[model samples]
Target chain A: MLTSAQLDKPIVDSDLQREIEHFLSYEAHLLDTNQLEAWDSLFTEDGMYWIPLEHGQEDPVGMVSIAYEDAILRDVRIRRLAERHAWSQQPPTISTHQVTNAIVTAHDPTAGTLTVRSRFQVVEWRKRNFLRHLAGGYVHDLIKIGEQWRIKLKRVDLVNCDGVHDNFELFV
Target chain B: MAEADPNWVERLVEPARVHKAVYTDQRVYDLEMERIFGQAWVFVGHESQVKEHGDCWSTMIGKEPVVMTRDSKGDIHVLYNRCPHKGAKLTAEGCTKHKPMFRCPYHAWMFRMDGSLVSVPHRHGYDGTSFDPDDPQFSMTPVARVENYRGFVFCSLSEEGPDLKTFLGGAITSMDNFVDRAPDGEIEVAGGVQRVMQRSNWKIFFENLNDTGHPIATHESSFLAARKTSKHKLGGEVPFQLHIIEGNGEAPEFWESLDLRAFDYGHSFMTAIFHAPKGKISEDYKAALDTAKGKEEADRIVSMNRHNTIIYPSCSPHTGFHQLRVIRPISINRTMVEIFTFNLKGTSEEYWQRTITYSNIVNSPSSTVMVDDVEVYERCQEGMESDGMDWISQHRGEGRDNLLDREIQSEGISEMPIRNQFRAWSHYMLGTPASIPTGGGDS
Candidate 1:
């Protein structure tokens, strides 16, 4: 329902495309380096981070999700990760993210909003030898404020979102 | 006949301590699959899961793959998920629509929604053979017994035992309160299911359901983090999210103040840890319940708040939160936990959303609280394999429990529930009489 004709129009503005790509790469860098507090600052005050439990899940409130965090809950998550007694993170998870196929799917110049879709694959290692590969598609709703973009919503749809999973200790 | 020595099964459990073999031995797990899971009432699925006719959902009762289906006549059936022609599973582990008939992918053998064989391809090939379509063996076989209490369905693999109601006994009140909390006196399985794998024995997780002493020790990281966040950001008046986590760090005296009740057949429940907070959401939910039922009845209903009710060997229901955690054993050292959230019909959307939020924060595998518990359980599984210890202790307030007619009441911090579980475990593992033991308080 949020689709628009701008999806077909290739982003002709090279400057805007470069800025969007830089923003995504920087976000991935923050996540991979465990800069969660700085990463949290990239979102608006009312921003949401969601991981849908099912494919094509549209409503987080009407259904369940793997991860749905607002600002307060996200802060709690960051705090927990830093706790000394957090046993699951005794040897904290190390991750590397590969992001590609970034596309500006929609743009509303008057509203100062743009929708970007990208594909990502993340490899995480923890507990000395345990490793996992997570592949997903990311959808971001960014609003421009004073020549900078802030994320209003970020939704991640994983290929195995509905599969039985082990403890997810860090952000994907 | 018997696999292991009968005396050894009895020796694995003692009054105040149990041997490590009960958890680490594959021989014991096999006997449990036969005597315990074979006779006990295990949860299959909820009726809401298969509402429409020909809707089928595959799940496991013990180690067997079974399917729960709704037929054209609105009758529900629990059948084995194997094709009679071959031993292949008919469907995967999920909900699917096989309207009118189910055609086996192996040989195209067709069967009705009720698991009756309708037809098979190349029927003339079996004309001279002993295969008869009318024979019961040629059709899908149902479990020994299937019973539905309210909308929840349970099946027993063995034919001889107490009925479902008798098996549930006094603990049935928890199930009643679960459904009656709905304004319309009904609830449906909604949202979605979240599954997590644990590297521990299934009984270890079951025993933890009512163990009040471990929350502060196991979940110290989560609660301390929440407390720090509340102090730094929210000025120390914790919100609902932080409140849930912080409550786990309650002092030992606080936990001792609450009461624990254990019923027959390894069922038990503890008093609510935190009362329903006073807020707009609570007010609105109370108003809706009052509108559906009178204020007096509504007051009576919500006042019966319980924390977690263990239905023994299958599922644990948190009535106050509208969630059920189903326990499925994979192997001796592996377990699967499936959490399901329910929606009370005729309630406000905001109420249901709160339930979903609770599930995400408290029960999901990504939950801050559960991740630590999972780690501890895994550590327990690994530690028991060492040669250092032989018996695990259950000596915390062991003999200080009151025995009633059909229930056991003890201090919330007591290990009465774990001891009581071993009582039922001994009964099942030894193939003893199913009748409830009388006048035995503590030994």
Candidate 2:
């Protein structure tokens, strides 16, 4: 039985797939380019950005999550990065995200959105010591606009989800 | 190098500040292992971690490998993770038991749940010798003292000292209200732990818990970044992330208005700048509380809002989120912080999500907010190693402290908490009047 509280499975049509690809690429471009201003456009007014601590974290309230960002926290991260005294970024962390394995798993027609999964390996070069690996699965919930799509929620599941991560300033 | 200086312990501590060598020096670190870690009531895992008869979690109190486990009779035990013979680690990390027995990997020596010697492979061979299984030397050595306050367990190696309740003193309200805030008056260790490695001394993190001055200067970048991101993303309408950032930029007057209480035994909790708010989360939780308990009791529970409560050198408990950050000093230069989230028993799903949400955004290792804070602590550490500086100042609003019985209250921006901690540190280092206060509360 499909209850009102139940979320419909997202549909992945060819055009929708193309739209998602464009949306993801745009989001990635904004992050890599340090264009946080434009990157913020992806989320809705009260949209959420969550990264689960474990593989399948059921609830964010009772359990600890790796990263939970509403609009404000995401903004703070962006602002901090752009600040002149972001000492950690004195030698800015250069990065190129190879977002691949783009597969549209489900679509919710009533909600006008779809759930897409992709494998991403973000190789970030910092300081001159070594490149850090941020290999993770990206779960994107995309909403349709007039002619484009916007991100409702983006959950990144890092391969090393529980490892001692240095600093994750850039959005995955 | 030269078998360590005997007088090094005496010279390591002073009233105001200790030398940087205390942090960076390996000699001092070893002595600290003996004096502090070897003797103090170090925190073991929470009771909920070992709910089942055989569940266990491995932890370190200074340089010792201690395993916290639950016995078959529902009693929790903290035992040294070693075999009586041949000296082998009894169990691996996160080991489970069939019943309540632990067998050593090397030599088949079995131990009971309460850390008593159970079996020996060559018992007949040693029958003629002075080998007795009942002897304390042959048995798995349990710690000298183990006590559980609320659901969290704490163990001390020293046979003589004040009990856990006395040692906790005025700051125990943090732990008490942590469980009391739950509708059913109980909390369970839920979710997983997030571990972060800090390249600074353990004291650095401890001091940062009550540090009000650093947020603006140290975390300015991250919070500022969060603000800009939120503003641009949400069309200048801020949410939780931005709220966290904006908290850092609170006026001096705002911070000064909040109370910072320092209790006996280096424990304390700061008044919240933003704790219980008129937000949807708090409102929903209040409703849940009203349903379970009366409105007055619920109001009282929520009103006891706090930021972080430092339980000395071990962990900091966030009463609001049902979370604890256990600080483990691995080396003089390296420290590991483990965050454990908990669930309020009999609370609605909304209440639990708030805790999880707080952990994800604030406590996580890769948190956008905490990364900058971590960086600056490392910066303080690196800078302290130079020959250029001697003392890190703690003279901020020092003399104007409000002393009420055993609890000292200071302005939020005051460094009284830091000085108060150093007083306890000096007492521990000098081994002066070496007795923890007895009775339930300090005051």
Per-model TM-score, in order, reads: 0.96, 0.85
Model 1: residues >4 Å from true position, as ranges?
Answer: A1-9, B1-6, B433-443
Tens digits of lDDT, candidate 2, B330-412? 88888888888888887777667767767777778767668777777787888887778665677788678777767788887
Taking chain A of candidate 1, what TM-score results? 0.93
- For model 1, the docking class works out as medium
For all the predictions, what are the DockQ values?
0.77, 0.47
Per DockQ, the best of the predicted structures is 1
Residue A114 shift from truth in candidate 2, angstroms: 6.4
What is the Cα-based lDDT of residue A91 in candidate 1? 78
Deviation in Å, model 2, residue B410 alpha carbon: 2.4
Give the candidate number with the greatest lDDT.
Answer: 1
Q: Can you write out model 1's per-residue Cα lDDT over B76-112, one digit (the tens) per residue?
A: 9999999988877888898887466778899999988
Tens-place lDDT per residue, model 2, A122-157, is 888876575888888998877776665777888888
lDDT by residue for model 1 over A5-77, one digit each (tens)? 6456566387888889889999999999999999999999999999888999999988888889898888888
